[model samples]
Target: MLKKLINIVVFVPLGVLLIILSVANRQTVTLALNPFEPSDSLLSVSAPFFVFLFLAVILGLVLGAAATWFTQAKYRRRARSEASEAVKWHREAEKQRSQAEKLATQASLPAPQG
Candidate 1:
């Protein structure tokens, strides 16, 4: 419930602002890919300015997420190693417990008659 409220508070205004910006900047702009020929229509893309703005924002988010994932790789490796170690220790403990129970049962039995 608290997460929903936070999302509503943060995203509602951001969505409204982006909508207003797109509405206000309805002009078509040309982006030229070839630096040698500035007027080449074959190497250019023409679209609304807001489209480019939104594309840049999306690209930045993707790059930031990728960087964070790469930086935390060491911690993920350590966690996997620790989990395997814990499993090994637990198996060893169970084996020892069963052996101890078997010895206790043997000691409780009566001696054989001569």
Candidate 2:
């Protein structure tokens, strides 16, 4: 469908770009976690530059998803309450409908002649 076409159009180019970047940035780099001791190997990780690039992208996506989920919690709660309210109303309507039908049948029945 259109979604697949859009994915192909968008992701194909992005994939190619990522591949190019990985190829161009094959040089190894070290990420130092110890701010006080920048040269401390114990708190550092070394990998290809593209590894860090991809990790950052993945981390950003995870954080963004979490933020979006947290922000939309109120809407989700409201939807749940609305759904329960609808169910309650529907049950009340059905009860009323059955009562009306019972009265209609009773009224339709012939009275015994005295």
Top candidate on TM-score is 2
Indicate the worst ten consecutive residues by lDDT in candidate 1: 24-33
Off by over 4 Å in 1: none
Q: Which candidate is the best by lDDT?
A: 2
- The alpha-carbon deviation from the true structure for residue 82 of candidate 1, after best TM-score superposition, in angstroms, is 0.8
User: What would the per-residue lDDT of candidate 2 be over residues 38-96, giving only the tens digit for each residue?
Assistant: 99999999999999999999999999999999999999999999999999999999999
Clashes per candidate, residues 3 or more apart or on different chains: 0, 0
- Candidate 1 to truth, TM: 0.88
Superposed on all Cα atoms, model 1 deviates from the true structure by an RMSD in Å of: 1.5
Q: Write the per-residue lDDT of candidate 1 for residues 1-114, one digit (tens) a residue.
A: 999999999999999999999998789999999999979999999999999999999999999999999999999999999999999999999999999999999999998889
TM-score of each: 0.88, 0.92
How far out, in Å, is residue 80 in model 1? 0.7
